[model samples]
Target chain A: MSALFGRSRSVLSRLVGALVVVLGVVTLTFFLARVVSPDPTNLYVSPQADQATRDQVRAMMGLDKPVLEQYVTYLGQLVRGDLGTSFSTGQPVRDDLLSRLPATLELATYSLIIGTLVGVVVGIVGAVRRGGILDHTGRFVTVAGLALPQFFVGLMLLWIFFVVLGIAPGPVGRLPVGLVDPPQTTGFVVIDALLSGQWAVAGAALQQLALPLITLAFAIFAPIARTVRTAMLEALDADYVRTATAMGLPQRTIHYRYALKNVLLPVLTMLAGVIGFAFSGAVLVEGVFAWPGIGQYALDAIQQSDFAAIQGFVLYAAVLYVVVYLLLDLLYARVDPRVRL
Target chain B: MSVALAEGNLLDVVDYRGGFRGPDGEVTEVLAGVSFGLRRSTLTAVVGETGSGKSLTALSVLGVQPRGFVRTGGRMLFDGEDLFAGGPRSFERVRGNRISLVFQDARAALNPVFTVGHQLIDVCRAHRRLGRKEAEQVVLDMLERVRIPDPLRRMRQYPHEFSGGMAQRVMLAMALVSEPELLVLDEPTTGLDVTIQADIMDLLVELISSSGLTACLITHDLGVVAQTCQDVVVMRSGTVREIATCEELFTAPRDEYTRDLLAASRLVEAR
Candidate 1:
C-alpha cells in the first residue's frame, strides 16, 4: 500500500510539473510578444498609410484591445483549439503550424534512428578495441563531428554533393516542386507516399532528406557516442561481466546481452538528451535547406514580426519538448528496474 | 585426506606463471610457478593473503587472465585434458559445462537488473539446448535444491531482494545448474558473517560430497579450509610456499608464511 501511494505521488507530481511548464510557456510567450520593439501592426501597414487605415489594421489584428483582455481572449480561443490567424498571411495559425510539423517530426525521427545506430555501433567498437586503431579512428571521427557546426556542415554537404559533384539534385523543399499531387493520408510525405504505393515519390523524398538527416545526425552523434563508449567501458569492468565470461559464455553474447543491458541506463539517459539536441539541430538544418519545416516558418515569422505566428510556433515547440521528455522518463523507468516510477 | 586423494585426480596445475605489464611495460608477475592438484570429490583450499595470487590461479584454470597480462608458462590439466593448450573456443565448452566459478561478492557477481530465476535460466540456456519453459523449470528446481525459501516467490525476486547468505546460495545454485564436474569458490564466504559462513561452507561440502564435484576453495580463512578442504596450498606474494594435507599443514607448519597465516586464522577464530 505504501508503494502504491508512492507511485501515485510520483504520477501526480509529473502531471503538476507538466501543467506548470505549459502555463509558464504560454505566459512568457504572451509577454514577450507584447514587449517587442516596433509594434506588429506596423509590419502589415504601409509607412504612408492614413491614421484611420492603421487603426483599422490594429483592430482587425486585435492589437487595439487591452493586454489582459487580449490574453483572456487568446486563452479562450486556445482552449477551443483556435490558435488565431496570422497577422501577415491571414491564414489559420493552427493549420499553418500543423502543416509544417510533420516535416520536422519526420526529419527528427530519421536523424535519431541514424545517429543512435551509428553512435552505438561506433561506441561498442571503440570500447572493445580500446587503445587500438579502431578506438583511435572512432575518437577522431566523433571529435571532428563535435567541432563542425550543423549549419556549416549542411552548407558544405550541399556544396560538395549538389554543386561540385552534381550527383544528387539541388535542395528545394521536402519533395520535388513539380510533384504537386502528394498522397494525403498522413501529412508526412514519405509515409503517405509509401502507404499509397508511390514508391518513386517516397524514394525521392528520402533522397532529398538524406543529406539534411546526416548533417543533423553528425551534429548530435559525438555526444551520444561518447556517452555510450563511457557506459560500455564501465559495464565491461563490472563484476557481472567477468562472471559471464567465467561462465564461458561466448564473448559476443557477454558483450551484447550482459554488458549492453547493464550499461543501457547511461545510454538511455544520453539518448534522451540527444532527442533535444536533434530537435535543435533540425531547426538550423531546416532553415539551411529551406525544407518548409516549422523552424523555417518560425524564422520567417520572426523576421516579419508576426506576433500570432511566432507565439503559436513557440507554444508548439514547448509542448513537443515536454511530451518527448515525459515519454523518455517513462522509457527510462521501464528499462531500469531501479527506477520506481 | 590421503583417502580423499586416492579417489582420483581431477585437476593438476604445474609451474603456472602469469603477470601484468606495468605502465612502464615491465612484467610484474602475479602468480609465479604455482602448482597444485585436486581430487575428484574433495575440496582443496588455496589459502593466501590478499594479492597472494589465489584468485589469479583460479582464473588461470579458466584461462581468464586480465588483459595485457600474458600467461607465460603453465600446464593445467582438467579431467586429463590440457586446459592451457586449448584455445578460447575449447575453453568455452569446458567453462560453464564442465567447470564453474562462484565469485566472492555474490551481489556484484549477479546482474542486478535481472531476477534470480532469469539469471539461472540464462545459465541453463547458454550451455544447454533447452526451451524457455524447460529452462525455467530447471531454474526452480535448482532454487529448491539450494534451499531458498518459497522457491517460486524467490525466483521472481531480484538480486537486491536477497540477503548475503541467500545471494551466495543463488550463486552456488547457478554454478551447479549445469552440473559442472569442478567448482571454483573464490573467497565465497569471505564477506559473510560467521553464522552465514558456516552455513555456506556446510552447503558447499554437502554439495561436493553428494555430487562428487571437485572444488578449489580460494580463501584466507584457515578454519574454513580445515573444515571444507581435504588438501591445502599456502601461498605468499606470487609463489606457493607449501602444499600438504589439511591435517598435515595445520598440525605442522613448514614455512614462516604458513605459520603466520595460521596464527592470523587463530586470532580470527578467537575473536
Candidate 2:
C-alpha cells in the first residue's frame, strides 16, 4: 500500500515538473520571438501603409501594451483556453491547430509504427547473425539513415517514386483537390473514411500518405536499430544468458525470451528519443509532400512572422514531449519491476 | 571417500584441450590437457589460482564455454555416457536435467528482469516438463529448502532486491530445483563476506550430506576445502597439479606447487 502511494506521488511530482518545464518554454519562446523579430505591425499591415493604420492594427491585436503587460494578458488568456488568432489564417490559433492535429498525428503514428517494427526486426537479426552479410547490410543502412538529412531524403524519395518512376501520387495535399472528403467526424480523412466505409477515399488517403511516411520512417529508424543492436549484443553476452544456456534451454528460448526481455528497456528509451525526432522531422517531410499538417501550418507561420501561431505550436509540442516522456516512464516501470520501487 | 571413488566416478573429464582462436587464426590454449574426475556422492573442490582454468573446466562440463572458445579435444563421461562424444548437441539432455552449475557471481547469474520464482519455474518446466502450477510449487519448495526467510514473498521479488547472501541462496535454489545428480559450483562464495561464505558453505555441506548428491566446488580458498570438501583437485596454470582425498592433500601434500599454495593460504589464514 505504501509502495502504491509512493508510486502515485512520484507520478504526480513528475507531472508537476513537466508543467513547470512547459511554462518555462512558453515564456522563453514568447520573449525570444519579440526580441528577434521585427514589429508585428509591419508584417500585419504593409510597408506602403501609413503609421496610423499600422498603429490601429497593433492596437486591435493587443500589441499596443507594454511587453510585460501583453505577456501577462497572454498568460491570462491561455488560462481561459484562448490561443489568440493567427494573423496568417484569420482564425483562432487553437481552432487551426485542432483541425490540423489529426493529419500530423496520423502521419506520425504510421511512420513510428513502421519505423519501430523495421528497426527492431533488423536489430535482432543483425545482433543474432553478427558478422553475416545481412548484418553488414543492416549496419550500412542504419548509418546511411542517420547520416542523410530528412529533407534531402524526402526530396530524393519523391524524385525516384513520383517524378522519375511515376509510381506514386504527385506531391499534392492530403487528398486530390477535387475528391470530396468523408464527413469530418475525426478530422483524419483516412480514419474517417474507414469508419464510414468509404473505401476509395480511404485508399486515396493512404496513397497520399505512403511517400511521406517512408521518408520519416527511414530517417528515424537509425537510432532505434543502433541502440537495439548494441543492447542486444550486450544482453546476449550477459551472465544471465549464459546461465540460461547452461540450463538446457533451447538456443531460441535463450535468444528470444531471455535476451529479448532485457533489451526492451533500452529499446524503449531509444524509441522515446526517436519519437521526438520523428515529430520534428515530420515538419520537413510534411513540407516536401505538401501534406496539410501542423508542420506546414507552423512553417507558414514562421515565414509570415506570426508570433501567436508560433507560440501556440511550441506550447503544443512541449506538452506532447512531456506526455511522451511520461508514457515512457510508465513503460519502464512495467518492463522492469525494479523501477516500480 | 576412497570407498566412494572405488564405487566409480560420476563424471570423468579426460585430456580436455580447449582454447580461443584469434581473428588471425592463431590458437591460444587456455585449457591444455586438463584431466579430473568427480566421484559419485562426494564433494570435490577444484582449488587453484585465478588463471588456473578451474572455472573453465566447470563450464566445459555443460558445453557452455564462452563464445570464441573452441574445444579442440575433450571427452566428458557422465555415468559412463560420453557428453562430448556427439559434439555440443550431446549434452542437451544431461545439462540442467542431470548436471547443474551455480556460477561465481550469483546475482549476475540470475536474470534481472524476471522474478526469482519465474526463473525457477522456467527451469522446472524445461527440464521436468512440468506444468505452470506444479513448477511453481516446486520452486516454492526449493526456495524453502535453501532456507530463504519467506519463500512466498521472495518468489515475487526480482534478483536485484536480494542481498548477496540471499541471491546466492536463490542461485542455489535454481540449481537444485531440477534435482540434478551432479552440482558444479564455480567460486560461489568468492565475492561474499567471510561470515556469509561460511554460512553458505555450511548450507552446502548440509544439503550434500542430507541428499547424498555428487558435487564439485571450484574455489581458490584452501580453508573451505579443509572445512567441507571430501576430496581436492589443486590446479595451476591451466593444468591439474595434484588430485587427492582431502585428508591426504592437507597432511601429505605431494606437488611443490600445491605445497606452496597451502603455505600461502596458511600465511593468509594466520594473519
lDDT of 2 by residue, B35-138 (tens): 78898899999999998999999998998888898888867888888888887777888888899999988898999999988888888888887889989999
Mind giving the per-residue lDDT tens digits that candidate 1 earns over A41-69?
Answer: 67777899999999998898677989899
- Please state the error at residue A149 of candidate 1 in Å: 1.3
Instruction: Give the lowest summed-lDDT range of ten residues in model 1 chain B.
Output: B1-10
For model 2, the DockQ equals 0.74
Most lDDT-accurate candidate:
2
Give the Cα-based TM-score of candidate 1 against the true structure. 0.89
**Model 1, residue pairs in steric clash:** none
Cα-based TM-score, every candidate: 0.89, 0.95
Docking quality band of candidate 2, CAPRI definitions: medium
Please give, for residues B11-33, the per-residue lDDT of candidate 1 as tens digits.
Answer: 88877887998899888887788
Go through the candidates in order and give each one's C-alpha lDDT: 0.83, 0.88
Cα error, residue A99 of model 1, in Å, equals 1.5
